[model samples]
Target: MPRDHSHDPGHHHGHAHSHGPATPHPAQPAPWSILRMTVTARLAAALAVSAGLWVVVLVAMR
Candidate 1:
């Protein structure tokens, strides 16, 4: 019968592994930062652009 080394702490699996939260690789883009615009600011800008588009459409329809 083969011995079970899977449960042995001293066993080596010849593979890399982690036991905690995975970290982002250095090549990946950083997460959002405080320096970026806030949700409210983004919403306001989107609304402004939408309003401008609506105005253009209304004028074009005339």
Candidate 2:
């Protein structure tokens, strides 16, 4: 689709576009509930993978 480049002479090109919503700070840890849940999920996934690999090794040793 072609963008409309049509402009009115009344529209000033000198206008600045410096306005937007503020984002959350990266340094700040997320909410306790959210952070705790995320950590739990990651740890669970890690432990699951480790256990799976360990089982594979054990079965191979047999």
Candidate 3:
């Protein structure tokens, strides 16, 4: 007597299973824009502090 493998319940024959559609990823900001914004903010802060210190030195010398 020969045994049959086609009727096995635990057998998988290279069939693909689906898990629904994937969500879209969010858009990213441009690298140059981000870098320019950061540098501009830092430069503004540095200039403000330098001007403040120069004003203080001038007031002290009076």
Candidate 4:
């Protein structure tokens, strides 16, 4: 019986085999620093809570 030569390792059909060494990416900044909320955010939160409290107080007083 004859052996098949279609699955030889010497043939690649013009495809890349080596990708070379991987380079390390630059360090990233702190995720908290990137998404840190400012004073305006706090003010908006306070205002929302104040408005909600005022509405509840008015409803209770009624």
Task: Give the best candidate by lDDT.
Answer: 1
lDDT of each: 0.78, 0.71, 0.75, 0.74
| Residue 10 shift from truth in candidate 2, angstroms | 45
Candidate 2 lDDT by residue in tens digits, 1-62: 97565575456568554543275434655565535567778799789999999999999999
* TM-score versus the correct structure, for each prediction: 0.44, 0.41, 0.40, 0.42
lDDT of 4 by residue, 1-62 (tens): 99877788766657664544375545667666514778888788789999999999999999
lDDT of 1 at 26: 43
Model 3: per-residue Cα lDDT over 1-62, one tens digit each: 99888868766668744443374545667765535667778799789999999999999999
Model 1 lowest lDDT segment of ten: 17-26
Model 2 residue pairs with clashes: none
Question: Candidate 2 — what's its lDDT?
Answer: 0.71
TM-score of 1: 0.44
After TM-score superposition, the amount by which residue 5's alpha carbon in candidate 1 deviates from its true location, in angstroms, is 72
Candidate 4's C-alpha runs over 4 A off are 1-35
Model 4 pairs in collision: none
lDDT of 3 at 2: 93
Ranked candidates (lDDT, high to low): 1, 3, 4, 2
lDDT of 1 by residue, 17-59 (tens): 5543376534547596545979898888889999999999999
In model 2, state the lDDT of residue 41: 89
Better candidate by TM-score, 1 or 4:
1
lDDT of 4: 0.74
